[model samples]
Target: MAKLFYVLGASGAGKDSIMNMVREQLRDPLMVAHRYITRPVSSGNENHIELSEQEFDFRINRGLFAMHWQANGYRYGISNEVCDWLAQGLDVMVNGSRAYLPTAKARFGDQLQVVWIFVTPEILQQRLQCRGRESAQEIAQRLERAIAYDSVRPADAIVIDNSGSLQSSTEQFLTQMENTVQGQKIKVAMDSPC
Candidate 1:
């Protein structure tokens, strides 16, 4: 069966960056799912549907989204294309908000593997500001929302700390994916004492 690798993180937690790294290292038979969105496409970011609220709701109610969520005033979705890939036994990775995990699990069961990309609030603020997308106030709001969501995590998940160098984080993520894909069980390591 196809493995659904669900990547989760707070806003500005560098989930996109980690996914990009994984993509570069992966070969054929592995792929990333492009999520649909009701927001306008930002240059050089993604392919998405720029629809109005009414149209988004219409399609959503029609059961078009395989999985969907509302975040930062935008509605995002994964389509049947993803389900098709999952049925093909491909390793499909999807980066999404925490709100969609339950629905994904209900649909995919044990085939779903959740990875939480964690970043500190200080790092998140810096990254968000550096991106120059949202205002400082908006970044603060996202941080608040992320904190609330963190408490209710998925039942099965692997936590990837991203507070350090990119190289280390990428390697860690790749190692986890390798183990998961090969059915090699591993335990989470504790942090070193300060």
Candidate 2:
């Protein structure tokens, strides 16, 4: 059985970078579900789809997105390719919202492994500043929501503190992922119909 590891974190917790790094290091088959978004392509990031608000709305009506959300006045979503990879027994890495975990778990069953990446508020603020895409007001709002998320429970999750360097955090992520994959296999087996 394969695992669908859904990585969740605050907006600036380095979830995207860590996922990319882990993918490069993984010897196993791994698929990254590219998120569809309405924001312009940020400099140095070229992998995402830059959809217009109208196009995003059309797709949402068409049920094209597996999961979608509106944040910072932009829309974002995960495509059905995520499930496609898991169906083929390949590991999947996705940067998703903790708010979406229940829906994913209900849909994917035990195959969903939610990993929450953690970072200090100070680090997150610095990253957001370095990105230079959001305004000070917007950054403050996002940080508030991030703090709120910290108080909520992420269902069936592994929390990885990422305040350190990327290398150290990647090592911790891989270590936790190894354990998560093994546990996911048991879940798949149990859920399999006799």
- Clash count for candidate 2 is 0
Top-lDDT structure, candidate number:
2
TM-score of each: 0.85, 0.89
Worst window of 10 by summed lDDT in candidate 1? 185-194
Return the TM-score for candidate 1, rounded to 2 decimals.
0.85
Question: Model 2 — which ten-residue stretch has the worst lDDT?
Answer: 185-194
RMSD (Å) per prediction: 7.2, 2.7
Off by over 4 Å in 2: 43-46, 187-194
What tens-digit string does per-residue lDDT give for candidate 1 at 1-194?
45778999987888878888878886656778887777777732554557778877887889877788887788888776777776655668888778877877777776788999988888988988888889878988988977888788765687788999877888898888887777623433222111
Encode model 2's per-residue lDDT on 25-92: one tens digit a residue.
98777888888888888643537888998999998899888778876677888887776666667888
The lDDT per prediction is: 0.77, 0.80
Which candidate's TM-score is highest? 2
lDDT (Cα, 0-100) at 11 in candidate 2: 83
